[model samples]
Target: MDNTANPAFDVTKRLRATSPKSVAIHEEAARVMAAEIVGTVEIACPVYIESASGSRLTDVDGKEYIDLTMGFGPHVLGHRPASVEKALAEQITRGWHWGIHNPLQHRLGELLLEAAPCGEQVVFCNTGTEATMYAIRAARAFTGKSVVAVFDGSYHGVHDYALLVAERSSDRRNPAPRRRGAGIPSEILETVAMLPYNDEAAFDIIRENRDRLAAVLVEPVQSSNPRTDIGPWLRELAKVCREAGVLLIVDEVITGFRLAYGGGQEYFDVDADLATYGKALGGGLPIGAVAGRTDVMSVFNTGSERARPIFSGGTFSGNPLTMAAGIAALTEMRDTPDLYPRLNGLGDRLAEAINRHARQHKMPVTMMNAGSMFHLRFAEGQIRSSRDITSRYVKAEHVFYQHLQECGVLVPGIHLAFVSAAHSEADIDAVAAAVTASLDTLRNDGMI
Candidate 1:
């Protein structure tokens, strides 16, 4: 590990030096916060944002950037969209939050159902993590089974269930479980079975463990790696889960609303027993939901079930602010013609342009995408899963991210990026040029 003084950190040092105010704030934040920033560690440098609008972000140092991360895949319409702002303003006047069911909840629920054909009913939660956790619980409650099958290199949430799988499972066919971090017990890890992504052999694993398995949870389009050819494999997985009486939970937290109005289910043309949603669903606000077939989701219904219903509730589950924003976002998605195609086209163009530049320079870098969600891998050759994204890519990716930042573009340091409706062709071209220049810089320094 090149932990000794490095160029990427040096670039960050240079960038941060320009913004002493952000540096001061980050220093203070480190004193109080666990990680200097909230959420996953995505970048080598911390660029503090003073404000964001449209496709751009303004740092505290007054440097502007073309934001490609788009708030980590939630801002489909981009930062401070008019429709979301208007809905939020109106909802703020009406009320911010309420413990009771609000009318806006029903409206948003209807929109979700209309968008997702698999959604016969819906339950609200605070984040994608909560939605996925509850979705697994509901599946367990309905199936009377304890074990849940999830794919390797796929992240459902930060919960214990999702973190059970090790980085390199010794047994590729039947991966061994390992704690993502300490404090989680073996008992919790035992309940999870990790399988390989896009591997047809996952069917056999599902069949062998049918009795103990309650659900098969997966992201139709993994936000971590972003492969475009997993649709057929996902369909097969969904079918096998149905045949085995195991519920299928599609974690569409990142792909939902961003890929299309109906998300991965719609794009792949597959049906899931339950689908967990978040990210783009609330426009820019924090919100999540579990939507699915009435029969499977009825585990949450109090009156219908003799046993106590699955415990699913949050203080601000169906709060008016998020509901209003969701309603507005979905409405815009539904009413706007060619929205998905346009966004997807922009994504395709960006990926193509970058890949072309990489090929011309004989760089090892490769860009992969599923509509607007994309990732840059430094090492090439058929990246099917997160495990396929080798450690060799880490240093190059950091260098690329830092160079792009220097070139006035912002992407998540180590995660997938999102292009928004606000991103223009010019933005795509600029990013392509930045990629070429960044790769050139790395080659000159013998870093690539």
Candidate 2:
């Protein structure tokens, strides 16, 4: 390949521009920042990216790499997608904030309602955290219940209610919902319950608290689950909720928009009382929303007299720029025929290559996927829940992703990888080659 020409497919040129700055900022961040940044983030040896475009990120050191992280799974359309970028630029010309509601949020929310599984109402928010927060509130308001149930190992943002962690206390991993990162109040956590994922006993767990249970929230697929087809499990859980007369709030923040235009609810062929979406919905910006049946949302519309359980307020919740970008992104996705299947196919190819390579090397590993969101579990056995995500899957080989980073590909860790609209056939192949080479290095060094 000639160096003079810019490969539309590769972002090497952009990557080359930010290498120095990436290192410098990180070094300085460690010197001045808190311990958490150093222990978990900086020590991970990640590059500080300067710029990004479809399927690529340029680090401060001026190195370009294929980004599998997608900024922690937001850029489903991939970085700086032309449609999203153009919409933002156009919004800037009009004005950044309209102060009163802009049509952007409404338009974006409309798309969500249309695409959602038979839902016609929506409440826009600014982030996934808020989406879950308000969705819980809505469920509580509608059902007159105080407690909510979430799955262990499934992330519903860092909200106090969702901070519950399951630990192996004795025979089974029991949930210990600690004020883990701090600042969360004990009173707030009272309303949340954590349960095992993919386990059939979820109903039994919820049955004890059925009277207080407002909703059952779960991710259709565990982003960190070592296996797939979690949709079926979620559908079963939804049935359990319905049988008990409790609301089902499908937390689709990570699984949404990416799995399909309508989100995991539609893809799974299930109906939810409420659902949340973010990350991919923004196209590449900050955007989130709660969508579901009209009865559940009536609480929000009943006025302050009702004192609706879901109280939401934010200055930029429905800002013009985000809405415009969201609209454009949704429009582009909608117009394209079978865009989601294309993404799923892309992930299928990459997953196949990785698994096949592992088999050939006689390496004990497993790969799982949901549309474009994919993960590689180092364990070869059946992974039914968070307990199944063993150290072998995330310990040493997880760190070995750094080598894959150096090989010019980006994935969050050994745990999760994302394929976006911008990811090309060549990009997938290159990432597969990087994974193979990276694992080879680990094997040769006895690092695996």
How many Å off is the CA of 401 in candidate 1? 1.3
Per-residue lDDT of candidate 2, residues 1-448 (tens digit):
7655422212333333335566567678778867533132422454776899889888767778898988788787888989889888988999987659876667788888888884678888889999998988888877888988887777888778877666556234335554556788878768887776777767687766789899988887777773456667777888888888888888788877778877777788877888888887887778778888877787777464566445677888888888888888888988988788899999999889988998889876666777688877777666676676566545446545666666888766334779888999999999889988877766765655
Candidate 1 lDDT tens digits, 1-448: 6744677767777777776876777778879988754553355556789999999999888999999878888899989999999999988998898799888898999998888758999999889999999999999998999999888778888888887665583666666767888888889877998887788888999998999999999998877778778888988998899898899999999888988899999999888999999988888889999999999888998888447687778898989899999999989989998989999999899899888888887888888998888887787676766776678756677677778888998887555788898888898888878877888888876887
The pairs that clash in candidate 1 are 42-413
Model 1 worst lDDT run, 10 consecutive residues: 36-45
TM-score of each: 0.96, 0.90
| Candidate 1 Cα outliers beyond 4 Å, as residue runs | 1-10, 36-44, 167-169
Off by over 4 Å in 2: 1-20, 35-44, 170-179, 302-309, 392-395, 413-415
Best model per TM-score:
1
Worst 10 residues of 2 by lDDT: 6-15
- Reference-based lDDT, residue 103, model 1: 87
